[model samples]
Target: MNNQRRTVLKSGSGAALLGMLAAAGIITPGMALADWNKAAFDAKSMADTLKALGAGSPADSKDVQVTGPDIAENGAVVPVGVASSLPNISMVAILIEKNPNALAATFVLPEGTEANVQTRVKMGQTSNIYALVKSDGKFFMATKEIKVTLGGCGG
Candidate 1:
């Protein structure tokens, strides 16, 4: 009787452990989709890209600030910064006008956290860089033109 009780308890504990692991995403049998759309990135213009990415029409928001050099010596890596003063910032996406794929990067911001992000992106040539901000269920944006002296995409 004692042996049977111990075996049952051990089996129950093992099942519980497996449940916890699955909840924590330690195991997944199939591929995972993370909201990536190739068609959207292939957009020809910034406006088209924004629409395809579901960003809607982003308004010019003074509360959002973008920092970057006015000119870049190398187009391969252009540093960009975005900081939002507004509340409930949900996301930040970087876009380059001249790149084959305009959407460079996208970041999801958690609640009650500071909305600031920085990253380097490749540029095909001298083009406009835009920072798209999502706050309060709306999209806001800021843009700057970065002149690239040396072609990074291909000379």
Candidate 2:
């Protein structure tokens, strides 16, 4: 039994060491970094956010879906989700129309990843939420409205 335990420990340590090496850039290069657009996230308007994201006036699409509560009791952490049935989806972004910053969140999907995400966002008041989906270098959107009784952004 002691010998079997030693063998298992050795195998686990070997796998861990390999993972550490890969993370340290010894096994693979340029695999740890992700593309992030800072300007889009900092934008305060829908148009600016689109421009920063290179979406260029997305069209409305039924293929995309936005899901969330119709009414939120607290504005501080309203749950939101975006999902797409469209093929080859590369990105998903969540935007709140009435927030100080329109663009709330952006997610970049790696190849072969399913185009779906859920997150909590702060909403100052009742507003329309937009889920922007990008597929094959083009953009599409879906919208939903959520009412907030208590202000989340310092009400």
Candidate 3:
């Protein structure tokens, strides 16, 4: 029993030391973090956001879908989702037409990842939510209107 206890402590201490080294930056992480797109998120208009994201004049597509309640009971926590059935989707972004910043969220999909995402966003009022999808170096988009009973972005 004493020998087993010593073995457990030895392995646990080694793991803890390695974790400390990583946390202290003595060891580098294997994965690199993606840089934030400040310009895209700070854009006040849909067009500007698209421009910042390098997607120009996206065509309307039935293959892209934006799902949300027609009327959001609470503006602060409106549920939304974006999905694309199109092949080779590389990115998906959500835009709120009425928000102070039109660009709400953007997601970059890795290879083999499904082109679908769900999230909650705040709405200032009744507005059209746009889902922009990028596939095979081309951009496509769809929009859905959501009415907010109470203002979330400050009435």
lDDT of each prediction vs. the true structure?
A: 0.81, 0.86, 0.87
Give the top-scoring candidate (lDDT).
Answer: 3
- Residue pairs in collision within model 2: none
**Top-TM-score structure, candidate number:** 3
lDDT of 1: 0.81
Q: TM-scores, in order shown?
A: 0.75, 0.75, 0.77
Candidate 3's C-alpha runs over 4 A off are 1-34
Steric collisions counted per model: 0, 0, 0
After TM-score superposition, the amount by which residue 116's alpha carbon in candidate 3 deviates from its true location, in angstroms, is 1.3
Question: Regarding lDDT, does 1 or 3 come out ahead?
Answer: 3
Q: Which tens-of-lDDT digit does each residue in 1-155 have in candidate 3? A: 24433443487686677567558654434422224676688799989999999999899999999999999989999999998899999999999988999998888999989998999999999999999999999999999999999989784
Q: List model 1 lDDT by residue over 33-111, tens digit each.
A: 2235555676878889899878888899899888888999988888999998988999888999888878888888888
* Per-residue C-alpha lDDT of model 2 across residues 38-109, encoded as one tens digit per residue: 567778888998898899999999999999999999999999999999988998999999898899988889
TM-score ranking, high to low? 3, 2, 1
